[model samples]
Target: MIQLVVSIILYFVIFFGIAFILNMLLRRTWLMAFLYPFVVLIIVDNMSTMEYLKAPGSAFSEAFSRLMQITPVDIAILVAGFAGTIVSGIIIKLLRKSGYQMF
Candidate 1:
């Protein structure tokens, strides 16, 4: 339990820390907003996944098995990477290009 909590906190900290650094290099107005945040989240998630790889829980494995739950750690990494590389990128593009009209 404690490990889980710690992992979540660490994720937030690392994500935000990377975000802060990114902000320095590029303004929030730019920097590929949606994609950038996801990239940060993915990096953080990867770290958490490493811990879970040590010993995947039986209860979790069984419960999430239907979700293609080969391993908890694998899931985390996939989710994060998927978010960063795919979902977030698409979202960011849509959002930035959304509300406007020009001829």
Candidate 2:
């Protein structure tokens, strides 16, 4: 619902902002673009924990534990993070191609 949409939007905003800053700092660096998605994975994982769990201390271990079940919202956040990373990369590539500098 609305919360999921908001979370996804927030994920995109953060992911894009980070990627954009890195892209500006490391121009012509494909590694950063490729690694952005993985970075988003970690960020979104943390964000998901904050969103869902009252006890944030255990969120990190719980987020990664395959044995510990995750909710649909977590999955959605992961998916959104991945999608945002990809979109950001593509947008950056296009911007570079068009010679429009952004940060």
Candidate 3:
């Protein structure tokens, strides 16, 4: 239980920090949120980018199977990471609204 909580918080903080920096540097509030799924895909799927391109059908099938096999705790961690990205976007938007320059 402790480990799960730590994992969730760790993923949230890691994703939040990364997304916050990305939002500032790119000056796009939701860029990280939009790209989070691809980030998750890279984390979840074992296939390399080249493998995905070379054998898209097989790679996608394998990825789907892997995704289906993920545990509930893993899903929760991923959701936390996704929430971090979204919260980062909202924070950036709010900061900009308050006249703070993100870039």
- Best by the lDDT measure: 3
Candidate 2, superposed: residue stretches over 4 Å from native: 28-63, 66-68, 101-103
The Cα error of candidate 2 at residue 45, in Å, is 7.6
The CA lDDT at 91 in model 2 is 81
Q: Write the per-residue lDDT of candidate 3 for residues 1-103, one digit (tens) a residue.
A: 9999999999999999999999999897888888988888888888788878899899888887888888999999999999999888898889999999965
Candidate 1 lDDT score relative to the true structure: 0.45
Error of 3 at 63 (Å): 0.8
Better of 1 and 2 by lDDT: 2
Q: Pick the candidate with the highest TM-score.
A: 3
Give the per-residue lDDT digits (tens) of candidate 2, residues 1-103: 9988999888777766766666677764355557854454455465554534576557655555632465778677766765666676788889888998765
Candidate 2: which pairs clash? none
Off by over 4 Å in 3: none
Per-residue lDDT tens digits for candidate 1, residues 1-103, read: 6765566555445544554444444535234445654443433443455444565574335434434533575355434433333433344346558942212
Worst 10 residues of 3 by lDDT: 38-47
